[model samples]
Target chain A: MTEVATFLFSAIRVSTPLVYAAIAAVITQQAGLLNMAVESMMLSAALAGVMISGATQSALLGVLGGVFFAVLIAMVIWYSAFIMKCDLYLVSISMNAGLVGGTVFVMYLATKQKANTIGYIMSKTVGKLDIPILKDIPFFGEILSGQNIMTYVAVIAVAVTWFLIYKTKLGLRIRSVGENPSAAESVGINPVKLYGISFALSGVMAGLGGVYMSMGLMSYFARDMVAGRGMIGVSAMNVANASPAGSALFAMLFGVSDTIANYMQIIGIQPQLIAAFPYAATIVLMAILAYVQHRRYQKYLAKKLSQSGFEI
Target chain B: MNKVRKIESIFELARIILALAIAYGLSLLCLILVTEDPLEAVYMFAIGPFTSMRRFGQVVVKFIPYALCGVGMCFMYASNRFSMFGEGAYLMSGCFVAVVAFLLEPFNLPLLVMLPILLIVGGFFGGLIGFTPAALGAKLKLNELVTSTMLNYVCLYFSLWILKVYLADPDITFFASRLLPDNVRLPQILDRSTIHAGLFIAPIFIVIAVIIFFRTRLGFSIRICGSNRDFAKFSGINYYKSIIWAHTIGGVLVGIGACVDLLGIYDRYLWNEITNYGFYGLVSAVLARKNPIFAPLGAFLLAYMHTGASILNYTSEVPIEFVQIMQALLILLISAQTFLRKTKNKLIFKDSQDAIMKEGKTA
Candidate 1:
């Protein structure tokens, strides 16, 4: 029972960054943009979080700086995609690559280190929260309480994203612009402006996720530490069809797989094989999703053909 | 019509040059901002690659892998699939080349026989890895971008596993595969540099790519599908087959490129991290506008910039990562269809107006 609870606890801890990434993905995906630069955003933010917190010795300022940097990168991508009319995918891919290099450069400039900011900076970390009354409960409380504060924020982020996406008037405009930009433009909603807003919102989410990685998850920012989490978040968002709650659930699925892999490493599995497990699982999940979506599409096509009086 | 075409082509060329200049200028600005000795850093970055024969050879060495992968990417990009499996394919294929060399060492095959087998085996496995994401995308309608990116990591970890389990030299403290026999490694061709027989082998694949792109029916269909999927479907082209074949062909080239790089560059399989040649190749492909013919030119330009960046890294305080940022800026500026769209439109419009006025007078 304790083992299961412990596993669930770590799963939530691991899922926090992914949850934010999924939320970020959900926002952009709904705005009819496939933003792969969530990786870039998270990475920049993670570094910024470490740098700011280390410099100023304030975690709050660090959090803000992290989000700001992410949003700034998002705006750069937005300018390229919307203003300059570059291919979004190409822009994002380049941005991802550039930022990976840029972060190392910046880290090198500040800390004179290439690997991580472990010894050079005394970075302040975000505090974990132990929920009152909930901490008293047996298995469930042990799983839920005393997680990194970012984990709670991730939960709130999902709810806020759901509200922003489905319930608000801005949500309607975003969806309208995404669905048919020409129609939205005819109705006086600028798709380009909505795209900026979407990018900004996603940046904010990615920023929080990055902050969790550096300040909350680990004490210092490590080079390429976000690794494939941002991409995994993308995969999660893809699997969930861009629904906020669903994306979070899928993100949790990755967290579970990752946790299992980490455990498997301790149990004498090859480290490389263990490291490969989560990604392999992600591919399998994607394949399944693709198959299901294809089947659905075929069915829809068949129904449409029949309705149009075409021969079966 | 000819004048309009010439004007448009001139505009396209101008846009590319302007993009290149801006990226270079911005990268210089970054160096000036960060470095105490701005002039020294900028000088090295701009003129360093051409300073000596050895440096130029380094550019050529880098150029081989970049051009091979760039040409490979032309096929994938032409298919409009946005598949990024090339990075993984390159890394894994390179690893496999080493693995194959090690496995065949006991057989005592000659260089002529052994080299071809290694290249073929590497290409086959690379093609197999490339086939996965493309086939998935073609048949099941998966997003090739996501699947391919995921597969890249999977390939990385799998390669690491292979390196650890079977091939890692026990003597080396840091993890690396066993060294290949001297006969297995490609012979160096350049006098004062690391340029290998891969230089000769790279052109063969480039010629093959050129033939496939310009001379083949399959290439025509792939191009048609890329440009207009609905048109291709209406014209009865097998869309799935074209997508799969394009990616597989790309995968084959990427694999061969990996083998070339592995044999040409190193004595042992030293890559523990992603080599990033595949990603850099995408930049080359995009710079060439996805034309296989222009891939070598694009690759050469990038190789030069990369060599300069490394030069800057060693000679000054600036890091080699500066090139990556410049590459990103280059991709953005060059690929932006609207960057000089107005000027292009104006030139074409003026040419059309002139033609119309002349036609009116003739009539």
Candidate 2:
């Protein structure tokens, strides 16, 4: 029972960054853009967060700087895609490659250390929350207590995203523009401006995810530390059909897989095999998800045909 | 009509020049911001490759793998599929070739007989890995991008395990295979420079790719399937067959390129991670607009910039990563169709109007 509680707690902790990235992905994907630049934004923000926090000795300033940098890059992406009319995927690939190199260069320039890590900087890492009365509850307390503040923010972000996407007027405009840009234009909505704003919101969410990686999870920044979480977030958003609650659920599933992999490593499993588990799990899960969706669509089509009295 | 054609060609040339100019301008700004002596850094970046034959040879050395992979990428891009399995294909092919070469070291076989066997085996394994995502996409309705990306990590971990268990050299602490035999190594083409016979293979393959792309019925089928799938299907082209064949051939080309790079550059398989040549090749393919004939030129340009950056890194305190930023900027500018669309339209419009007025006078 204790092990299960510990596992659930760790899964929530691991899912926090992924939850943030998925929110970012959901926003852009809803705006009719496939933004693979999430990884680049998160990585750049991770480095920026660490550097700023180290210099200013304040986590709040670091978070602001990180979000600002990510939003700046997101705007550049918007200009490149909308105004310049570049292929979005190609722009994303280039930005990812550039950030991979740029982060290392900037890290070296700032700290005079190797490009791999900034472990010596003693940055302000985010503190964990310990709710007073909640901490005394039996099983629930064990599962919920001692998580980073970002984890709570991630949960709140899901609710906020849900409200913004389903309940607000801007959400309607964004969805209409995504569904059909021409039709939206007929209604006097500027698809380009909405897309730019959506991209900026995605940047903000990805920035928070990046900060979680450096400040909430680890105390220092490392090269390519976000790894493939951004991509996994993309897959989660797809599986969820761009719904915030569904994205959070899928993110938690991945987080569980990650925790299982880590546990296997601790129990003396081969490190290489353990490393492959999360990716293999993702592939299998994605295949299953695709199959289920296909079956559902087929069933729905058949039901509609039957109701309309069409021949077999 | 002829005058309009000439103007269109000139506009295309001008667009490329403008993109290059912007990329270089941004790079200059970066240097000025980062370095103490920005002018010297810029000079070294622009002119250093020509200062020595060795540096020029470095450009040629980098060009071979990039051009080969670029040509390979043209096949997949032509089919309009964004599969990223090429990175895994390259890495695994190198791993297979190293294993083959290690086993063949004691046979004392002739180099002519041995090299072809290694290339075929290496390419076969790479194609097999590449076939997975294609087959999955066909059979299960999966996204090739996600599947291919996942497969890359899977292959990386699998290869690392193989190296640790079967191929590790106990003498070395790092995860690397044993040194390959002399007979299996590529012969040098130049005395002072590290230019190898493998460099010649890239151009030959490029020529072959160009011929196949331009002259073959299969190539036409592939292009049709990419541009208009419904039309291709209506015209009785087998979409699945064309797509599978394109990806398989692309995988073989990249695999061969990986083998060449491993044999020509190093004595042993020393890579613990992905070499990223496949990504560079993808960039080259994009730069060439998925045209096989232009891929070599694009690869050469990228390699030249990389060589110049390395020279700058050696001479000044500036980092070599600036080249990556410059390359990204170049790709962004070049791929932007609307960058100077107004200017291009005006030029073509003027030419067409001139042609119309000439016809009116003649009549």
Candidate 3:
């Protein structure tokens, strides 16, 4: 039970960034856009959040800086895809390329440092918030209490995103635009506008996620640090079919697989192999899904062909 | 009409040059940010590759496989699939050929004939790498990029697994396979140049790719499919077949890259990860706009920059991230509308819903 408790808590913390990016990915995908820049956004935000707070000696300033740069990169992505007519996903790649480089470039500019920086930004980490009368509670406290403020934000963000996606007018437009753009266009909806806004919002979500990760987790920004979370978000997005709640759940599952890596490895395989847990899991899951879908599609095609009595 | 054509041509050239300039500028920014001796380090990073004949030769040798991968990818991307499976294919090809050379020590076969045979086998199997996602895309309707990327890991890991299980020399310290027999090696060209038989192999196949691409009905069908599948259907082209063929030819090129890198330099089968040769090759393809013949120059330029970065590494505390940043710059520049064609948008994207559905299904 103690082991289980420790594993779950660590899993939630590690899984937080994936959740943030996955949430961001879901919102963007909802608007018919595939943004690959989430990784870049997170990296820049982590740095900015860390740097600002480090400079100001204020965690709030660090948070603001992180959010600021992430949004800026998001805007750049929006401009390229929306106005430039570049493929949104590819543009995301371009933005990712630019953002990471941009952050690195700025790091050199500000600190005259090469790749990595010294200390967490503001030299301040996100402090844990102890809920009143909760520490003495058993499982509930173990799971929920003694967590950072960002944990609550992630929880609230997940809830709000679910609410917005299912119960809001903007959600309908986003879904409509994504599903059938031509149809949406006929109904006086701007597919590009919806996508642009959604992508920007996705960037912001990713930004917030990055900020929380930096201050709340490591309390410092490192270069090339986002690693594979962006790709993980891509995995989570696919697994959940862009459903916010589903994505968050999958992200946690992914985090658990990752958390296991920190512990003992099965057989002789190192934690590095298991570090690819989310990707490997998604690949297996996807293959099965594809086979089923293929069967279903073939059946439908066969039924339609048979009814027509003529092969077109 | 001629004047208008001239202006458009001028603008296109301008864009290409501007993009290159920006790519360099970004690297210069890295130089500035490292806050080093701006002029000295930047100059070394840019012009350091040409400081001497040996350096030039080293640059050429590096450019050799890069060109091989580039021209190979040119054929594949020209066929309109944005697949980077060549990375795994090239690495595996090199590894396998290394293994084969170790076992086959027969003196009966002539050097020329034996080398071609190995090259052909390597190319054939290497081409097999291209078959997966191309097939998956056609048959399963999956997004080729995601499928190809995953397949890369599968191929890389599977190769490592094979190496660990079958090929491990028990006494050796590092994770590497057995050394190759001397009889299977390519005669080095100039003493200085890394130039091997594979460098010549690239051009030979590139010519074939060009002739096949422009002169044959099959090639025409590929171009048609890339332009419009619906139109290709009316013109009697097989989209699936064309994709497969393109990837197959691409595989051959990539395989040659592996074989050359293996047989020419290192005589052992060992690679911990897929080399960036495939990515560089893809960059050459993008820069060349899928034109097979134009790939060498682009490949050389990218290689030269890599060498320059190597030079930079010697002089400073700057990380390899600088080179990767250059890669990002190259991708951005190459994928831009004018640097290549406006075709990047068409080839690189799928319908969002379709892509999500396909990638999701595969994921």
Candidate 4:
């Protein structure tokens, strides 16, 4: 029971970063752009936030500062795609590289550290809130109650994104742009503008994820600290199919797998062989999604043939 | 006298000169910002390569594979797909070839017989990995960029796992493999430089790639498919077949590059992560504007900066990791410009603007 409880806790903590990244990536992808810059965006936010917090000792500024810098990066990518005749993938890879260069360049100027920041930022971690009656409850209270502000924000983000994507006019435009930008433009919709907006918003979300990393995973900004979360989010996005609720669920599942791997190391499991498991799982999920898409495509063709009264 | 000629000449010069200026300025900026005596580090890192015979040799050692990968990537990009078969080829073929080299190096076979065998096996593995996305793209008409990038990571993890489980030397705690015997080592150039036969091989292959890209029927089909794909389909160019060949060629280059890098530089293949060499090659291709012939020059520049940055790291406080970051910055700048220019061409805001101009003239 205790092991299960600990695992569940660890899962949520790990899931927080993935959830932020998945949501960020999904928003951009749904707008007909793959935001590979999310990695840079996240890193930019991480460094900026920590610097702000370190200087001011204000956690809010840390969160804001991170998102602000990430937004700036997203804007550059958006403008390049919208105005210039550049390939989206190429632009993304470049922006991601630039993010590292720009940040590392600035890191040295600000702190004189090469690999990481020089200061120790002790920004406040999100305080946990326990409902009085819920706290009295046996296992339910312990499992459900305590999590950081980002956890709450992530939960709310899932609900908010679901409502926005399925129920709102903005979602309609986002879908139209992704499926066929030419057609979207025919109806007076600005596909480029939509992409630009979606990408920036996605950057904001990814920036928030970086905050969770600094405040929850560790207390300070470090070099490449987001590690593979950006790519992990890419994996989760495949599973989610850009659906907010699906992404959150898969993000949690990924977090759980990560938890198992982390604890198994305590029991002397080989870190390396087991290390490939999450990526393998992600690849499996990608293969499964492809299979499902192929099947659906075949089914749609078959139905269309029958409806048209075509020969069998 | 000729407007088109003048514009072309100007833009061409702008491309090369501006790029170099950025590179030079960047190094200067790093030196100035990171160290008190910026000139000393710059001189040591960049100019220092030619100052010593040994260090000059080191540059040659690193230059071969970077050039090869860059040229290969140029072909892939020219096909209008970010297939990036280089990564798949690099990891799959390099790891397998190294294992074979280690196993065979002990048999005392003549180095001549062994070298070709390893290179072929390496190139074959490279082509094998390339076959995946080419086949997938032909069947599903899926986006190649995302798929290829994702696959790179998967290949990295899979290779790392194999390296750890099967190939890692059990006697050593460090994540290195059993060093291969010296029998298969490439003959080096004279004492003036560390130039190996691998350096010569890169140029030869690149010359062949240039010939194949321009002169051959297969090359024509690939180029046609990239430029006016619909026209190619109308002409029965077999777009799918062309894509396969393009990626296959790319994979072969990656394989050869991996082999060259392993033999020319390090004693063993000891990568715990993706060799950014493949990525750097892609950057070279991008900078070359998908020109296969020029790609090697681009690759050389990138590789030189990388080597020079390491050289810089010794004397300056600036980290070599910053080189990776700056390279990324250069990529983003070029990629963004390319992406935006593509968008403009596709939309032709000019067409609409031209229409408005015509109406205004009539009014």
Candidate 5:
């Protein structure tokens, strides 16, 4: 039971960054943007957090710095895609490619190490929060009480994302823009402004995920440390059809598989094979989701046709 | 209509040149920030590739893969399907070709017999991988970009697993497959360089791609579907078939690229990462404006810059990763619809005015 509790704790801990990334993806997806550059945002943010924390010796400043860099990248992407009139998808792809190299370039300039900032700099870690009453419980407390502060923020982020999407006027405008941009413009809402807002919000969420990665989870920035987590989150958002709650659930599912892969590596499974599981599983789940969605659409079409008295 | 097209192509060329200049300026800025002698680094980066025959040969060798994948990407982009399957296709096909060569080595086949078979296997395997995301996108409406990227990771690890399980070179310390047989390795064409027979092979594939893209009905259908979907639909074009064929044919070219690249460059199967050849290919295709005939020009520019970056790597403190950032900038600026929108509009406007006056005089 204790071992199971430990596993659950690690799984939730692992899912924290993913949850943040899913929220980021969900926001842009809701705005009808692909936002594949979420990966790049998180990456640059991770490196920024490390550099700032190491330089300033303040984790809070590091978090703020990281968020700032992520938002700046978001604005750059917005400028190129919107102001410069570049293809949004192509811009996102270029941002992903550019920012990774940009981060590495910055990191090498700062630390003179091309690989990581493990020993070259002294950086503060984000504090872990232990709940008071919840800490008294046995297995459940162990799973729920003590986690990185970012984990708690991630939980709140999901709730806030739900509330912001469903209960706010801005949310209504964003949705209207996504549904039909020309219609939204006819009604006096600028889709471009909403896209910029969505990009900023997503940048903040991705920034938090990156901060958690370097300052909370690992205590230092490693080159390409975010790995495929950003993409995994994007896939989660896709599987959930851009719903905040559903995205979190899918993220947790990936988290569980990721935890299992880690343990499998310890049990003598080839690391390469074990590492492939999450990506392979994501593809399978996405395929299944697509199939189910397709069927639902077909059923809806059939129902509408039958109601209109049209023959099959 | 012809005058407009001619004007548009001219503007397109101008956009590419301007994009290249800005990207180079950004790279130079990065070099200035890093190096003690900025001018020397800049000089080496800009002009070093042309200074030495060996370095120029390196550019030619690198150009082979980039041009091959770039031509392939033209087909994919022509159909408006932005699938990233080319990356996975090349890696998987390269591994498959390596494995097949290992199997075929026992027959003592000559180079004439062995090379074509390996190329066929590679191209076929890549097409199979390519068909997956195409089908998923066409039939299931999954995002080909995301699925194809995920599949690249799968292919990378799967290929590595295959190497470890079936063909690990016990002699080598790294997790690489055994070296290919002597007869299967591509013969060097240059006197004192790594430039191989692939220098000829890449152009052949490029020519074939050009013919397929410009001279074929299927290519026409793909272009029509991409440029105007409703028109294609009303015209009774098969959208799904065009999408699938575009990706599959692109996959075949990418697979051939992988085969040729492996044969030209490596003695053993040792790829451990998703070589950004596919992404670069997509960038090349974009630079070409999805025209297969111009894809080589894009490929050559990228190869020259890459070779220059490597030269900087050897002589200066600057890392070659900056080239990626520059390449990204190049793609963004080149593809920006509004980069020089006013200038293009003005040129077209002037040309139309001139044409109208000429028509009036003729009448």
Candidate 6:
């Protein structure tokens, strides 16, 4: 029972960053932008946040710095993609590569250390929350009691994203722009501005994800540490059809797989092979989701035809 | 009419120059902010490659694999699919070459006998990697981008496994394969530089790619399919066959590039991660606007920048990665179709109006 509790706790902890990234992906994807540069934004933010926090010794300043850097990068992406009319995928890929190199370059410039890591700097880490009432409960409490503040922020973000996306005026405009930009423009909504806003919001979420990586998970920045988590989150958003709650669930599923991979490492499995499991799971899950969506669309078509009294 | 064509070509040249200037400007700004000796850094970045014969040779050596990868990527981009399996194919092909070269060492085979077999095996495996994504897309409707990206990681891990289990040199502390025999090593082209026979081989493939792209029915079908799938279908082109062939050819090129890079640069296979030559190739292809004819130029430009960056790193406090930022800015600026579209349109419109007026006056 304790083992299961420990596993669940670790899973939740691991899922926090994915949850943040998925929410970010959901926002931009719903706004009809292929924001492949989220990984870059997260990486830049992670480095900026850690560097700033290390200098200032303030976690709040670090988080804010991270978000600011991320939003700045996102705006650059938006400007390049929309205003300059560059291919979004190419721009994002270039930005991703740039950020990877930029982070390492900056880290080396700052510390004259190895480009692979910036762990030596005594940066501030986000404190974990141990809820009093939750800690007193049983195995369930053990799973829920102590987690980083970013984990709570991630949970709140899901609800906030759901509300902002489904229950607000701007949400409607954003969705309209995604579904039919011409229609949105006809109704006096500037699709470009809305898309820009969505990108900014996505940047905030991705920034928080980066903060979680550096401050919540580990108090240091590593080169390419986000790995393919950004891609995994994008896939989660795809599998969830851009729903905040659904993406959160999928993120947790990935988190579970990740936890399993870590546990397998304890049993003497090769770390390299184990590292590939989450990516493999993501591919399989994406295929299954695509198949299911296809079948559902077929069923919906059949039902609609029958209702309209048309022969199959 | 001749004047208009001249003006248009001049404008095209200006666009590339403007993009490159802005990219360099930004990189200079970064250097000023970061380095204490900014002028020296800038000088190194701009003129360092040409200052030495050795550095110039390094640029030539780097250009070989990059150009091959670029040409390979041109096929896929021309076919309108972004199959990123070139990265995996490069890695896997390198592994395959190491394994084959090691196995063939016992026989003490001559370079003539071994090289062709190595190329064929490398190309076959790489093409197989490329085919998997294409087949998956054709049959299952999976997104090639995601599948290919995942396959890159899969290939990396699988290659690592092969290295650790089968080919590892126990004498070395780090993960690396046994060194190839002297007979199997690529013969150096230059007396003092690392430039090898692979530089010659790279151009042959480029010529073949040029021929295949322009003088073949399959290439025509792929181009047509890429431009308009519905139109291609209406015109009786086999969409799946064209796409599969394009991707497979791309994979073969990258695979061959990997083998060349391995033989030219290293005595043993020591790559623990994706070579990233495939990504650089992709960048070269993009910069060439997916034109096979211009891929070598694009590859040369990238290789030159890298050589400059390495020189800058050697000369000053600036890191080599500063070139990555410059490359990214250049790509973004150059790829931006709308950047100077209004000016271009205005020039063409004015020229056409002038021509029309001339015709009216003559009549």
Which numbered prediction scores highest in TM-score against the true structure?
5
For candidate 1, give the DockQ: 0.80
What TM-score, computed on C-alpha atoms, does each candidate reach?
A: 0.96, 0.94, 0.84, 0.90, 0.97, 0.94
Tens-digit lDDT track for model 1 on B67-160?
9999989998898878888888987898888888988888888889998899898889889878899998877767788888899999999999
Question: Per-residue alpha-carbon lDDT of model 5 for B1-363, expressed as tens digits?
Answer: 898898788888899999899889988898988989999998999999999889999999999999999999999888887788987999899999999999988999999899899989989988877888999988888888888878888999998888888889998788788888898999998887789999888888789878888888998998999898889989999998888999998999999999999999899988888888888898899989999998888999999999999999898778778888988889888989998889889988998899899999999
Of candidate 1 chain B, the 10-residue stretch with the lowest lDDT total is B313-322
The best-first sequence of candidates by lDDT reads 1, 5, 6, 2, 4, 3
Q: lDDT by residue for model 6 over A181-293, one digit each (tens)? A: 99989989998899899999999999999988988898889888787677778778877888999998998999999999999999998887887888777877777777887
Q: RMSD of each candidate?
A: 1.9, 2.4, 8.6, 4.6, 1.7, 2.5
Native-to-model Cα distance after best TM-score fit, residue A60 in candidate 2, in Å: 1.3
Q: Which residue pairs show backbone clashes in model 6?
A: none
Q: How does model 3 score on DockQ?
A: 0.17
The runs of at least 3 residues in candidate 6 whose Cα sits more than 4 Å from the true structure, single-residue gaps closed, are: A116-120, A295-312, B1-9, B228-241
- CA error at residue A241 for candidate 4, angstroms: 2.3
Better of 2 and 5 by DockQ: 5
Write candidate 3's Cα lDDT for B1-363 as tens digits.
Answer: 344455456655566567778888977886776645878788878888899776776687787788878888877777766666787787667767765665566654667766887887788778888887788678766656556655666667667766777677778899888766666777777776666666676577667777988899878877778767788878778889998888877888888877877777776677876576777787777667677777888888888888887877787755545666666666655455544444433333333446568789999
Clash count per candidate: 0, 0, 7, 15, 0, 0
- In angstroms, the error of model 6 at A9 is 1.5
- The models' CA-based lDDT, in order, is 0.90, 0.84, 0.74, 0.75, 0.89, 0.86
The TM-score between candidate 3 and the true structure equals: 0.84
Q: Report the candidate with higher lDDT, 4 versus 6.
A: 6
Q: Candidate 3's residue-wise lDDT over A1-312, tens digit each?
A: 877887788888888888988898888888776666788889888888878887888887778778888888888777656665445555554455456656775676566665567642345677788888986799877877788888778878888888877799888888898889999999999987887778777877888888877788776566667865766776677677788888888888888877776675654574435444555566666566677888998889989998989675
Instruction: Summing lDDT over every window of 10 consecutive residues in candidate 2 chain A, give the lowest-scoring window.
Output: A111-120
lDDT of 4: 0.75
Q: Is the docking of candidate 2 incorrect, acceptable, medium or high quality?
A: medium
Q: How would you class the docking of model 4?
A: acceptable
Candidate 5, superposed: residue stretches over 4 Å from native: B1-3, B350-363
TM-score of chain A of 1: 0.97
